[model samples]
Target: MIDETAEQLRERVAVELERARARTALLTDAVDDDDLIRQHSPLMSPLVWDLAHVGNQEELWLVRDVGGRDPVRHDIDELYDAFKHVRADRPQLPLLGPAEARGYVATVRDKVLDLLGGVPFEGRRLTTDGFAFGMIVQHEQQHDETMLATHQLRVGPAALNAPPPPPAGARVAGEVLVPGGPFTMGTSTEAWALDNERPAHVVDVPAFFIDAACVTNREYARFIAEGGYSQPRWWSEDGWRHRMEADLTAPMHWQRDGDGWAYTRFGRTEPVNPDEPVVHVCCYEAQAYAAWAGKRLPTEAEWEKAARFDPATGRSRRYPWGDESPSAHRANLGQRHLAPAPAGAYPDGASPLGVHQLIGDVWEWTSSDFVGYPGFAAFPYREYSEVFFGPKYKVLRGGSFGTDAAACRGTFRNWDFPIRRQIFSGFRCARDAEPV
Candidate 1:
């Protein structure tokens, strides 16, 4: 017999699973069969692949892993195994067509839901606290964000729409000083945090001054105007090589037009808004821009300390503002707006140190490379985080407007190749604080 607490958790997990499926439908429904199959870039899988991959992961964890059931479609496992197939190669595989993929996912979800009704939440670590269900929800939501990226890359009229974000209010311009101290870095208590965020550890961070808000297009444009790309001093040797090879002059989707800048977003080209936070920039570009501006990108530790540390209590809150869940007033999240709110928006979401937009708007690139915490151990699978721990990828913290609550916790870690500019990424600058 399940206790009241366990029953409540089960119900919540069921609802979340359905909600994820609903969101997936919205993304897939917006485009037609042809759109689903079309690969927007070599960097991303076709939308239909992501659609079915979501279902495959759900079935793998919920039905086979948790429920101990026979594989519904064991033959197609390799086709959907993310590690087994690369994004560029997926199109050549014997992929299920749009209608067939939808049907497969629908059938898998129905079975998973039925299993959830009776699956005990206490038998194993994965089942305990409904962690498996939560993981699946986060997985689907992650894919949803990926699909949204594909939408942005697709060339056509806008197929998705949302109202513009609220206007920015008056914001004090300056840096927030975070005192040198020890603070908790990761979360061991978050019920659904991924393996990468597990085994909470303490970090000793030095005093530093970080930007109060994300770097705006106006600010980044300064770097471009000063011939930041042509100047090799600001960029690392590798970054300089990549920059010269790609011949990049501005952020992705941007072009110079008669002493002004124009950018494409969600299939619409318009004048770049100088006040808005710049998005779609890679870590290398961010780093170079920081160097040109006489600043540096904050380390992941510093970024977390700024976002989560409460100086008065010396405790890390679940978010920058507090332990409260995110909402429209607190942050611009869950794809409510296609673009970031203007800089200085979300005053209420400011951290204890008066840092704004740390939890949303765009994924902030950090100076840290992707690595596991002390005493870290993979759960349920190693391919998720263990395989990616290295210098090849840089870490990105803070969730983006496209990020969902399930995957947007303060301890959550995102990593990508430094050359990846297709993601909704941006960065703020930091500097060493002067000693008293």
Candidate 2:
């Protein structure tokens, strides 16, 4: 993306926008209209709600905000306002039917494509490098990931499919050392980076050792076998309380199949592959597992250091592999696979210090809470990230198989409640290292 002129940015935005819409269509079109109308889970919006909501956002940002056009459907703006309705109550509203939602989104996208042809990219911060357009692309992609999770939560058979990722053929080490010192922690240069990841600043991190690959199902099973959940010592007071209240005995979708454990994904039930990075484990579960293994979850700074920092260059890169961008050979991203590849897959995606799969396969939970870096300033809108900066939400780094390359980067930060296990989440362990 080097020396990308406004023209190239516009093209990139268009391609990414189309890619996102394709994915959105794939997710929404896979299921029946009844499924789309029904809320798959209380924690997620009805599929039909998501279908139209993305259109409203596109119209709000691209058609209206950037194009100075009238609202496509000003009457329904409140209906699609995410803050206005909880996921559980979304289905109760007189929501757009599946066909109507599809039509609305398509209408908005057509208008957006027209605006993209001539939108100025130099006059304002939002249009600088087509930032607003990029933001909308990312928003839709993020919703695509959300809708994929909705599919996973649906009560029917698998509605989506993708080939499994590569096997963990390369024997990976247990952990890797991240040599630490003063290194830039955030990004001031990533054109599409969100407010929280902005105004890159120096962070003095100490040396630490992090899991070379994510904590796999095999590794996590050991924790479960060792009375990990029943034992309170390994869990924090809050974690133990929640574990008991939620009756969380294992990762979501996992159950005891005769002679071994089985996992269900997208309605397919199969024996859990021990080598795959464990998914659906919340922050508390990840933290407890780390404690059970005598390790700890990496801080956001440590995770980023292990991910983007290169000792030789003494600088940060856009991704683990490099500033170039994600590819199938580099990382498992863009929903190319339905689930995480076996641990140790994607050796090419490893960080310079030999930290593998740092960018994708699963969203690795960090020990850090969601907070803005120093000198952070909200641009375009404060609701994007400013409203969520608190100790309540834990930050997760890296992307998942469902995460699009256009939306995820080393500086891209994701956060959720610690007890929410419905998302595609996982973890890698880390610990302090003695000075060499």
Candidate 3:
């Protein structure tokens, strides 16, 4: 076993390496060599290039950072490296087989672990351009998820399956009743936060009672059974438009079979477990559900305050569990799979105020819009947040089971189009300034 410090670094590196391997397999497993060359959209790259691209990223960061021990493979520039080449030219490049590309990925990760092992955690930023070592760990994990999505798009439902649905109606009791005080909110550090989380500032909120756990399918059914979708007052105009345009009567992929509800996941159809967190519901769906329940979603500030500002600590944290990195027992992340785990599976990852599952399982919808913080600045990844500060998107906190533990930090921000429902998403509810 590795020591605590060494263990943390090793765990971080090992998790990425494992994800890289899974991604490579996912890309190659059921995909045909011909289909790999077809264009899906400019946003996605060819499956054949996935490993090579990951290898190029690893070489750029880990290998080059260690010492220019290896001149990157000559053709890697044309074959991968989106920053260097356009998607239009991807099919023309030579591709490496699963084994060879994964080998390169492994070698690079081993070198990063070796180099990181000797360095202290304090103030250790890996990139000369100011990217932290943590960012590299997170970058690889993000790529892993991309590969999963890519495979799912290219190969169909068999390519990716979500985890088992959580048990229905499982109630986790405990709520932090905030008195609705004036609290400082937003990002505070330049450490590793995205631009939108910057310009750290303050916001005063009224006291409210937020559900300890996210809303479950069983709870949602009560609304649906009573014609939640039929009620215009429960939905925003935009949400109603989306519902009508998409002809959505229930959560995406859910259907009514006979007198009961069934859902399709990972290519298989199963009975909806009413008590489990309602997976695949979009922001619009969550909003409607909340309104029907006579509650509302918490603002990002309210969510952060409940988890970060303690009567004792009086500060936001990198994680709800304080300043430490997450472990397997802490959150259901970095598990090399895209799915919402049980909400109560990670009690250890709870916030200081007893907020459960504040780190992972699913990305919780915050009432906040995706916007710039008070004094935001662009970094090397200039398009990161600046490109999405518009009104069509919303902010999601906590990470999903599909995320890397490193990316599951409390300060992390995930934004999505308000009506998009393809991701592993769910939501918790907040009530107006009162105890339950």
Greater-TM-score candidate between 2 and 3: 2
Predict model 3's lDDT versus the native: 0.68
* Pairs clashing within candidate 1: none
Query: Residue 131 in model 3: shift from native, Å?
Result: 3.5
Q: Candidate 2, which ten residues in sequence have the lowest lDDT sum?
A: 1-10
Q: For residue 195, give model 1's deviation from the true position in Å.
A: 0.9
Model 1: which ten-residue window has the lowest total lDDT? 1-10
Q: Candidates sorted by lDDT, descending order?
A: 1, 2, 3
**Mind giving the per-residue lDDT tens digits that candidate 1 earns over 191-253?**
888899988899999999999999999999988999998999999998899998988889999
Against the hidden true structure, what lDDT does model 1 obtain?
Answer: 0.91
lDDT of 3 by residue, 1-436 (tens): 1234555655665565665556456655655655555555455676656656766766775667544556556556556656566766766666676556656666776676566555545454344223345456566667665655454344344645445533322347645676667766666554555456666777777887788777777788788889988888999999999888887788877899888799766555678876556777789989999888888899988887776666575666667787778886677675444455555656776776677777777778888898877677765456657877878789888877667765667667888888867666789988776454
**Overall lDDT per candidate, in order of appearance:** 0.91, 0.91, 0.68
Report the alpha-carbon TM-score of model 2 versus the true structure: 0.99
| Model 2 lDDT per residue over 1-436, tens place | 5778778877888888889999999998998888989888999999899889999999999999899998889999999999998889998998889988899999999999998889988879998888898888899999999999999999877889888889886788688988869888888888888788898999999899999999999888988988998999999999999999999999999999986799999999999999999999999999999998889999999999998898888988888888988898989999999999997788888888888998889999999889889999998789999999999999999989989988899899999999989999999999999766
Candidate 1: stretches off by over 4 Å: 1-4
